[model samples]
Target: MGSLIPCLDLNLIPDYSIAVTPKSEPKLEPLDEELYFSTPNPISNSDPNPDPNSDVIQEFSPVSDITGEESDVFSQYYRISQLFQSVFARKLPQHSDLTVVDPNSLAIVPQPEETGVSAAVLNYKKHSRSAEMIRVSTLAVEDARYFRNLVRTTRMLYDSLRIFSSLEDESGRTIGKRMRGDLRAASLMKSRGLWLNRDKRIIGSIPGIYVGDVFFFRMELCVIGLHGQPQAGIDYVSASQSSNGEPIATSIVVSGGYEDDEDAGDEIIYTGQGGQDRQLARQCVHQKLEGGNLALERSKYYGIEIRVIRGFKYERSITSKIYVYDGLYRIVDCWFDVGKSGFGVYKYRLVRMADQPEMGSAVLKFAGNLRTKPLAARPSGYLSLDISKGRETLPVLLFNDIDSDQEPLLFEYLPKPVFPPYAFQQLGNNFGCDCVSGCSSGCFCAQRNGGEFPYDRNGILLMGKPLILECGSFCCCPPTCQNRVTQKGVKHRLEVFRSRETGWGVRSLDLIPAGSFICEYTGVVLAREQVALFTMNGDSLVYPSRFPKKWVEWGDLSQVFSEFMRPAYPSIPPLNFAVDVSTMRNVACYFSHSSSPNVMVQYVLYDHLNILYPHLMLFAMENIPPLRELSLDYGVADDWGGKLAICN
Candidate 1:
């Protein structure tokens, strides 16, 4: 089996008692202000006057020769062009299973004659495939990889469209004010037959979607077939589709939208939909035994398992609330009750099914408790309270529960990478943007990152890029700048705990959102030549190249954004250095290898301008549940013999 890092040897430095630090720090030369403020050049060093018909020029060329209202349209077009240029620059390998029935059926908006702008710039659209055009997927329900790919791709496309719509709004266009970004994206996907599990509805748990899985929007639930209803609280199988020729409840979302609904970890009192004046937040009329209400009664009689999703108000998120799939539940009982509005309402008592993973909401509450009082929660298995010893912003606990081993191999805990003198010498010149408050669109640093900020307002990575350029030390932007994400050490509370299957592994004490920065791989940076010498001397080195390039699988926007619009990423020279973390490393070193990982490694540049040796940062690939072991694909064979070798 192939190894993750070809020459990775974990048994480096037999004596772990010694603390190794960089002998000398490289002195960086002062930046020349004249050179720093100079107008930045385009990413590509191609001809200044390229052919007008060239796809690159045509798609990315600045819009000129426009006046008045047309300027807003053109500016919006340019913003979208830049967004595509920054985010979807890399062309990923297409999945063989993903087949469009009608590849030529493009969804192009009618261009207004006044603007005379390209239809592609007016509005990004999906390949408008009819419902009949969708072929039943041959992939099995248990095919986790395919399911992940489908969900991720759908999400990426949705986000890309949402960002495009936001760009239009930013450019002073008020086109989609009533329709939300998610709804708009969902509409596009639905029109193009890009959604999954739409042809069938399952009575039990949806395959590939596990209990504790989270979603930010109702449309996402519909796209993944977790629940078909977008706004309705209850989803049901119609009488025609049911086995007994009777409507049965399939799933329900408990969002506390109704005053009568009650949620207790394992049990939920779900209120039937309808008969409520949503505008007045009250029930004006009595609910009739029909639709979802009748389905619940039938489910109770048939003993059918109904999927329950719990929703919570999430102020930090743009969606305002988060939904967690709480697993299967059976409607044990149903009855009519007078709600607070003094109107009759139907209530169904749903009990969680047996022998399933812990409820996602319960786990979240437990995680919150653990975070508030760590000592009271665990009480045992803790080797050290704060592993960083006041180095990191959050505590990194060292835990041992499965074994009698007192502690992991002794090594100095470092939060960031320590570069040798030679590594600094490789960095020739450092330049920064002159933005006063923060670096936004059109800033030199933003231009270096392809004319847009790499991260969103919440500091979430907008999309995976070949190389992400962040504000450097010379930048005038404050530390709180949105561009500086990975630099902000460890956003989530993580702990290194002993695992029975994978030795010492890391798990988050807090829930990690998808695309949020996790932590950086901190250690002594070794140059290309020095890396070989250290390897020959039996020192373990981590090769950034060994990490899987699954960023391509994030999503496919071919139908949404035209192929020609996505130009090749600016050529970033291959990174040559390896981080020697065998002796002196952070929690990232203890992360176990998995064929299906929840985290991804992203190369980023911040402290230095050298793109050749960017810092290796890890970001959550999906919404990770609390206490779940964090894993990453090590770019090795699944059956690799050295899998256990990574366990330290």
Candidate 2:
């Protein structure tokens, strides 16, 4: 979920501290290079009498610093870092036999049958200087992933210990609650909840979250439910088990709340910051389901994403925005709560996955951090489209017809689309950028496409130079390299809507700023002759008998106008192929035509270099309000096609 998830309100200060497990904040010792490397605490081992040389590093010197590029035994250093982290954890895996598989070498290293704790520690400490090495190492992103996981795990593992220790010593409930309050007087960054509290935009009644929405409401790590309320279902805490002996995710209810108080006698009337009564409604939901949204017969939501506000042992801190994006879950069951309050309330119990990466505040200090940022996205929505009667769950779309139920004909007759170039080509022995400063100066591809990096920092398309282009697979750069902007997909909140005038149209569920990637109109690639033949035959099949044959004539004329754009964008491949979303489609096919459209199609040549046709991508040309229809110019669609009566 990208820009779509509504930001929390700002004005209303939420008291999330229901019962803070009291634990005193640890004092941060001054940074001392020598002290950090020396054994602050002896390594714990099963040996009742430890070896005198256990703490000694005979082979390596005490590590003073860890700059990723400087170390020769970087691999060995990384492995030991992981080992130290495991030892730091409360629960350790019992290793009687370990199978270290090296697939590339087709080799397997097996541990001895009598393997025990002493051997494990001995094996781990083989890299005599790893502890100090890790402490000093910058911990590049490649090596930082495990370290981040370790920090989060340790915090949670020791939380209970702190609580117990605090109870034994302090005799108070709110004992050491100031762990995050650093006391350095560092500015407490405004939280997402604070921002949302200030937002007064009330859609029907509630500000951002609603039922049927997927991954919309981001729950805080320790928070199990609405700030302090107990009416709805609480976010299940996976750390603990439930009545069913599973992770506890149950009792989340969002009820109408319907159109008006007259209908929703069960409406819970709440006061806003301005002291006006507000009602959270089910207005956004339709009893009549859409063909794409995958909702159950009774339940609305697909599932939700869980985020925990991870607290660290101290050092740097991560903002609430950088959440561990636990993947989406499925709604197991939902039923009418039938509360006495007369609200048409419903409670949905979600089934959390037994295994998934925990998104916590534990991020690498040096390697940036692991966070769930708004996806520079390609898919229109966060969750997958549901399987409906006319559509299969396997993504299907056909652009020519609105109810395009056919699979791409090309797939049946031809091989599936391959990566760019398809076959190897010799390096032209020409100048190519290091991708560091390459985009700024002399990369021929970048100069022709305007700046090397097409998108700005927030993944926004750089203005003035609007023709979207990116370095293809042939480019000697990693995928994460900056020059690939359009490759990153639309991060906006969008939905396909059915209208009276237009069968289906695309719109942003969230407000979209100009220069955002609205969507990419993708489909089967066809040759010019193939598309000509397709329309010639498709005209009769698609146009209903009830409509006059003049529609067919108009379709032909529209084809001509659409082709006039061909010569202008040589990159758009010859009118050789047009994207067909009718059979397998996304939100792009639903976009309607407008003379002054909010979005426009731009040609991009990346991903597939062999295909002469540049991918005609969609981007927002102007600001689009929430729930406003998005349209394309449709290439002078005075007649048909652009303003097709049946847009898939």
Candidate 3:
């Protein structure tokens, strides 16, 4: 094929733009094998029964036009036309009488393959066709705009319809299987012992046999892992339903030999309803077979197992149970206490439990390390249970920190959860077991004193930084200090206190003063309960769980306001810092006595040195001294003998 790329100004093109040209036709060696073309244009026929993708176009020749000097532009267009003809010839069979062929026959050139081609090839053809169409539209400047818009609209509509059809099919499938109680759906088609989608088929392995065939999978559900005793089986659920609203299985068979059909025992009836009941039924069936009572002829089985693993006294104990349903209202599993001490090992054999023993009770396994290789012995004392009712149950797993005996609560694995796992919806206290410290961090059973933060007095929690107190730690010591200097400067108003007795007064401080760093206060952030009872604008707020309320809420409000204030800052934005002079220790702790005071707290300046802008005189408290303690009396009387009106 000849090179026919339009001469685009090098300076006008972006880096991603590449010249469109055909590679040079390399000289064929004597030993080179000749290339072959199809005898007929497979893409020309629209046979419905042909290979699903036989008619799909593979490569498209773009019509490159040069819009420049008449001769040069026509020459470029001619070369592009010649190149298109060459590619067409390369992909089509030779004709004995070329002169007899029809001119319109160029439309059907590249023959299709018996099977579909790669997506890459199809995409390339689409882009090439799009480029050709665009070039054709550009012939007339006015026609370019209209044609571009029309093409864009058509492509958009096609994409929208494709997505809409896909969604519609999915909705139909979901609705059709809604009546089934099983949590999983079996694809009408199956492959590789795994589930497949009913609508879209999976593309076969790349560059392998049957590469273009559509593959199907069914939603298969089996017990993935057993947590507790071998006797206590795990719960399984499916969403598929029968026309009469009966639950159906959603999985395919994997493995397991039934020595005798009778050995599997009578079919366990799941009287309960909902997704949970179905799961519980599956668990029950598993436990019955795992336990010797309902013998399993085959030793090995391929299926997901769910069980309740109970941990106490720093060690984990697993229990096995059989899920049984008593109508829709009650669905639970029966626990079989088969004593075994294999941690992390999946056990299949099970034994019956002595009673409906509560799971959280202290129990220890001492025969061998649970992590060691599994034993074939008929281990006794594995706990199991029947699903009594409801889709959930308070976790029977107990966690006790060795540092502090306080028990940590964990929720059991509910196959048919009321809500999808980790949804963070609803206020239910039953959060799944602490997956953070469990699987990810690796369970350190012997760590910590409840694994929580501690707090200090004064309602201040220091976190991520250090704090220092100049004065010695004050724990209700009598105040005693002298020679305290409290001075307010004209330019930078400052208050200096000289204490001799206690710390901040005039008695103990000496004249020759050299500053020295005080001991640092090192502590972590306080517990949420430390300041549970605080007021924001006099509206009481409480700590909810481990997070703070009100104060943090106000901080958030300030931050949002600051965002809007950015454009108007220094002109309309209000100042951020507000010093509270009500308290003597606070810089803004100024006091006054007046029913109708003239002064009020207002934005002063961005800098700390500047006082309140447009300074409003203070109505100072009565008997105020130069060095005496300053206190703000909120409920003081004015000279007119009226009570001060406090806003909040």
Q: Which candidate order results from sorting by TM-score in descending order?
A: 1, 2, 3
Per-candidate count of clashing residue pairs (backbone under 3 Å)? 0, 44, 97
TM-score of 1: 0.76
TM-score for each model: 0.76, 0.32, 0.14
Each prediction's whole-model lDDT (CA): 0.63, 0.32, 0.19
Q: How are the candidates ranked when ordered by lDDT, highest leading?
A: 1, 2, 3
For model 2, what is the C-alpha lDDT against the true structure? Answer: 0.32
- Per-residue lDDT for 412-443 in model 1, tens only? 88888887654454344347888888776767
TM-score of 3: 0.14
Q: For candidate 2, write residues 388-464 as lDDT tens digits.
A: 22232123222222344332232221112222343235445343445543453245555544323445445544332
Worst 10 residues of 1 by lDDT: 24-33
RMSD of each: 17.5, 24.0, 33.6
> Best candidate, lDDT-wise?
1
